[model samples]
Target chain A: MRVFRKQDEMTVKKLVTYLVLGFVGLFMLLPFLWMLSTSVKPASDVFTSFENPIKAFVPRETQWRNFPRVYDTTRAMGGGFARWYLNSVLVAVVVTLGQVTTSACAAYAFARLRFPGRDKLFLGYLATMMIPGAVTMIPNFILMRKITEWLTVVAPMVDWDASRVVSVFGRTYDAGRLVGLDSYFALAVPAMFSAYGTFMLRQYFLSIPRDLEEAATIDGCGLFRIFTTIILPLSKPALATLTIFTFMGNWQSFYWPLIVLTQDSMKTLPLGLLSFMGLYSTQWSLLMAGSMMMILPMIIVFLVGQKWFISGIQLGALKG
Target chain B: MAQTTRGRTALAGYLFLLPNLLGFLAFTLLPVLASLALSFYAWDLFTSPRFVGLHNFIALMRDRDFWYYAYNTVFLMLAIPVNILGSLLLAVVMNQKLRGIVVFRAMYFLPSIVAGVGTYLLWRWIYNPDYGLINTIIASWFPQWLSDGIRGLGVEWPPQWLTSVTWAKPALMFMSFWTVVGGYNMILYLAALQGVSPELYEAADIDGANAWQRFWAITWPMVSPTTFFVLTMSLIGGLQGGFEQAFVMTRGGPAGATTTISYYIYNHAFTWNHMGYAAAIAWVLFAVVFGVTLVNWRFGGRIVHY
Candidate 1:
């Protein structure tokens, strides 16, 4: 009788737990559902659906054109979304490539090779992570401005003012201004060498067996060749983890991009969306559509690389 | 182990490090030192810096807006416990050895990686008094009296959340909680929970300990290290939190209700062009973060079981 009573209590507890979890899960999922709902609702239906909350979740007629309208630069609602998308893609891709390359090279040194003051230098590098980013923002801004001024002085004295330099996307500077204000270089370059990436990669590299590298060295392979042939191939998971993180970070970066790229054409998606909010604060459907566009790539990436994302986070936790 | 070989290896190491070292020197280390120095000197971007020892810090103490923003920042950190505990509870639920748990975990973790600006904007829509999700849901679900009673207690009916001064900070805190309740914190806790040995629970069961006793004596102690880690990280992040949300949703307004130290610093540096003053604010923020971290390490470290 007592065992049956205990069994009944266990059933009750389990049911309550599941019920609570389901409710909280629904609450957590509501915003995404609402965002999707808002995206497809016609502009008039958006405000009207608010009268009935249930109707708000279900669009009267799905406006699929809202997605394309986001990219239509000619429309009042679509202000350079294509340009911003291109800029964001370019910056994220290039920055990820640069950061992974630099971090791997540096990690190889710190993890594998002997160096004077190596441990001390690494400690210093790690310590920099503790210094909050707010401390660096002002000084970096000043430095960027100084660089622009110095470039103006050193580069050919063009008759054109700095403001007239159309874009800073090209390798050749025949149009002048390689990295000043409104430049992709300014957007991507400062973010290319990550201390966290180097640290994580070093930890990963240290876990690799020394026997493989020693054998490669005996085979007349130089350090660069060994790194490229052996370590790079071996550390695919680590590289993928770092690449996904760096790309997502750069893609969604707001403040630095906002500071550097004042021109409309140079704005990344997040910055573009910020301006979109300012201009169309009341247009809920349009704003939702724009945001959906902004976040779609991130969601896709997360879905595709969900395993790496979870493991990467778990790895960082282990380091801590 | 050979000296000559060590010397050659060191050269090779330096060659590998040169690119990152140069970038780090130019970007991070030098700028960090420069920021400290710049806090002492007054400079607009167009003008030369003027040496003004401790003037910025002194001015900050006198600035009413700075104090208000600082208060707002500290107030928003009230959500830290909410976020930490909510994530812990969810992690407990998630740690159950059940079928299809990964899908639920993934759903919970989704909001965290969804773009920050997008999340903020979504919340902005949700907090809208007239047509927002929160208001609409409340109005539809709750009877008239409850809503009226809530308003009688002096909240705006359907709460002008981000727009109201009293409600804005709480609204922002709510958003922070929503973001983290199933995020990396939960994942960390889940990871920590998985590491707890089954033997501890089995031993407790053999000893006739109840579920609550088992949790407190075994599960709690086992997860304390993760708790400590989450606490430290959350506190540091909480201090720096309001800038992005406020920048997107509030712009530090409805009368600077959501203004935070980070936001204030950004404004002073960029919008106002008070670089020295901004650096001073940044330093103060750093000092607070550093002090809090130190305290957590000193006190909280004792309780954490590795």
Candidate 2:
């Protein structure tokens, strides 16, 4: 009986520890809860705090129409959300794929290939990571404007006003001639040449054990074969980590996309939502709704890949 | 054979890195170098830059707002260390291997995930005095912080936190702290806790060391590496402060109480279009970051048992 009682006490202690952590965790999570609740709350009940933070969770009624309102309000903005979502998805996917490929290729080269200048070049890559992106924003935007000018080997057929055409970017209204996804190239191409991803991946790839590659070489495996069969499989964790990071970053990107994408039809989510808020300041509920929708995909992605997400973060922060 | 293969490998390596190299040069590296050069010239998005050297730097040194920006940013750096203590205490309690840990970890990590625009909007709503969760709660308890009122229980009314000049900085600090809580630091400390050797615990038990002794001796020493990382990252991020939060929340509000150096720099570059002056502001940030990072790298390395 005494032993059982002691065991019960220990269990209670354990439970208390968990409860304390759980409460703190919930406290950390309050900002998000506040967001979720605020998102669904009726406009009348938004500011009123009774027992809890939000009225939706409280006894007050839920307004499901808020979501639809957000969707409708955003659509009124020249590109609407459908366009912004498409643009964000297109940009993020293309940038992630491009960055991953670019990074993997470079990292592989640096890690496995015995080049004379490789170390120096890798060092050069690492050096650039120290420079803040904000510092580079103005110059990069200017550079993109120049690229739009330079990439007229096949001139875009649009006779338009100089303000819209010559400045920021030019466009062709005729969709029939526009092929191979033009905006995709514009946003993704610059990101494909990202150095930070390469620097990180190179460090990761270098940490990989060399014994397996050595055996593959002895077995007469070609470089491509070894990379395809062995290196690709082994480096999945690093690759996944990079993929997730690049996806999230490109997804949430505001400043760069804001600068380059001039056509209202071509706006990405962050820029689009910001512009929408500016235009529709009166529609507080709608603004919150769009904000929720913008970040929903990220939350879904994180929840789905929580294990990998946690592992990747812990690994990157600690290892780097 | 090895030497020839090594040379071939070098050629192949360069070829593989070509795409990234091109992108880096075009997108990031060139722009950064250009910014350093741009600091010496005046350009307003369009037209050629006229070389007017040292004027921008000179203006930054003399600018009153520049000093104010520095003060606001440093206010955060000063406040954040105190802010992190609450979380550290919580982590110490939470780090125990108890049930529902996964749930707790998820809960703590949710805010960081909800960051950028979403989190910003939430805080903005909460900071709204008339219809905010914070004021309603505070009003119920004391009713003084929101407006003029003395509690019958013998308490003086605090000023409007987010609006009052004296309390504006504190309000901003509190909101920022509340947004993150102990999140990333707790995750780090949790990892550090999990990595502690059981042998150390067993040895301490044999030596008659109590929980406090074991913690100070075994846990603290073992977690030094994680501590170093957290501290360094915190210091780095703390100095820059959060741009969007300040921008959207206060717009440097309540008589520039929340105006950070980064925000000021942003205003110059984006809003005011003082490109040279903005770049000069950026250089000041860079210098400060460089100095602090150097100091941290040295001090963090020295204190870190690893």
Best by TM-score: 1
Q: How do the residues B186-278 of candidate 1 rate in per-residue lDDT, one tens digit apiece?
A: 989898889888998999999999978988999889989988988899889878768888999889998998999999999999998999999
Give the per-residue lDDT digits (tens) of candidate 1, residues A181-262.
6766778888988899999999999989989989888888888899999999999988999999998888889889878767
Candidate 2 residues A1-320, lDDT tens each?
A: 88799799878988777677766666676556566666676786664546534433452666778898776766656548877888789889988998899888888888888777777887888766655566777676666555545445446554211222122256433111121222445566777666767766777777889899999989998777777788878888878888888898888776556556656666788777777767865455666778889888987887777777767767767443
Task: Give the Å error, residue B99, model 2.
Answer: 2.7
Who wins the lDDT comparison?
1
Which regions in candidate 1 have their CA more than 4 angstroms from the true location? A1-17, A49-51, A73-79, A158-177, B1-4
Candidate 2: TM-score of chain A is 0.81
lDDT of each: 0.85, 0.71
Backbone clashes under 3 angstroms, per model: 0, 2
Q: What's each prediction's TM-score? A: 0.94, 0.88
DockQ of each: 0.73, 0.57
